[model samples]
Target: MRTQSVLVYDGDCAFCTTCVNFAERRLRPRCESTPWQFADLAALGVTQQRAEYEVLWVTPAGRVHGGAQGVAKLLLSAGKGWAVLGALLTVPPVRWVARGVYRLVADHRDRMPGGTPACALPAHLRPSAESPATAD
Candidate 1:
């Protein structure tokens, strides 16, 4: 088993990097946060395509959580007040809403503060349940 969980994200996206920086600075979650470009996805049991599409939380045991679920896992590891918010996020009904919120934020990230056009995934790279993040 791996010794630590890893948080993987898109370093190329300014918005994404800023968010990660905020999480690291403020949330202080106890995990190794790395840009997917620098991570060994195969070793983390994460696929390059999936890493390109969404943020990921790769557990020490090799289980992978994506998008909003991954954020919840990250929060859970942060301890104290963060764990409470994380627990709330995992509640079934709340999780569904969180997923939608995450998707919306992802879709418009290019327009967010600190973001560049590079932060927006082309429609072709958007997430879908059937094929992960494949386009229509």
Candidate 2:
């Protein structure tokens, strides 16, 4: 967060883009969504590798939340319903489950709707997981 809150994601992944579309249309948070590639990563204190691994929620306070927490934080910026949902998801057992589920979806995003084999992370960035990593 550099005075402005933002949802940082991968620009090269279609699956990621699809999710972002849903967030924009449905959640309609006050925050802005930007591809990490187009954002000032150094300024945001976001590493390229971290951005490749998970969605990030950067707050004006410079607090960074990753994965399920990040999603929840982004939703928290939306209206009442979304804020409630976000709060619920960020709590105890729900947060634990959300993390696992997020990992599952992220790990197999190439098989998800709007996903493609090309959605996989680049070689160098992927040090594991079938000689490469899953989608962004």
Candidate 3:
């Protein structure tokens, strides 16, 4: 069994929506995902700005994980070969690189799979891609 978590993502982005659908079919984590625009952010301790900028995992216990870490937790909870990849991504050097890559892809996501020019979050909503600190 899996503990419930809310996987908050950008519903308006086609790339993000397709990625969520991919996870739904492949990872099959127990979490229920929603666009932050519709989910109750206050109840989850997630800021709308943050949700707009990155993936968020909020557990029933109120534990919050954001960005790549959030994706990692979701994969591990899914219980499959995917967990191994998720675990590896959490290791030190790989974790560092993974976060960087995640940010890079996020910044260029309008060019990613299923992405469209209009799939991007507004400029104000996008964190400074140069500063990892800002994304957190």
The model with the greatest lDDT is 1
Q: Give the TM-score of candidate 3.
A: 0.85
Tens digits of per-residue lDDT for model 2, 49-131: 89989999988777789999999988888868899989988999999999999999988888999987867757344333343
**Model 3 score (lDDT):** 0.84
Q: Tell me the TM-score of each prediction against the true structure.
A: 0.86, 0.86, 0.85
Clashes per candidate, residues 3 or more apart or on different chains: 0, 0, 0
Candidate topping TM-score: 1
In candidate 2, stretches whose alpha carbon ends up further than 4 angstroms from where it belongs are 123-136
Off by over 4 Å in 3: 1-3, 123-136
Residue 11, candidate 3: how far off, in angstroms?
0.1
lDDT of 2: 0.84
Model 2 Cα shift for residue 97 (angstroms): 0.5
- True-vs-predicted CA distance for residue 104, candidate 2, Å: 0.5
Error of 2 at 23 (Å): 1.0
| CA lDDT, every model vs. true structure | 0.87, 0.84, 0.84
**Tens-place lDDT digits, model 1, residues 34-136:** 9988898898988888998799999899999999999999999999999999988899999999999999988888999998876776533433213644537
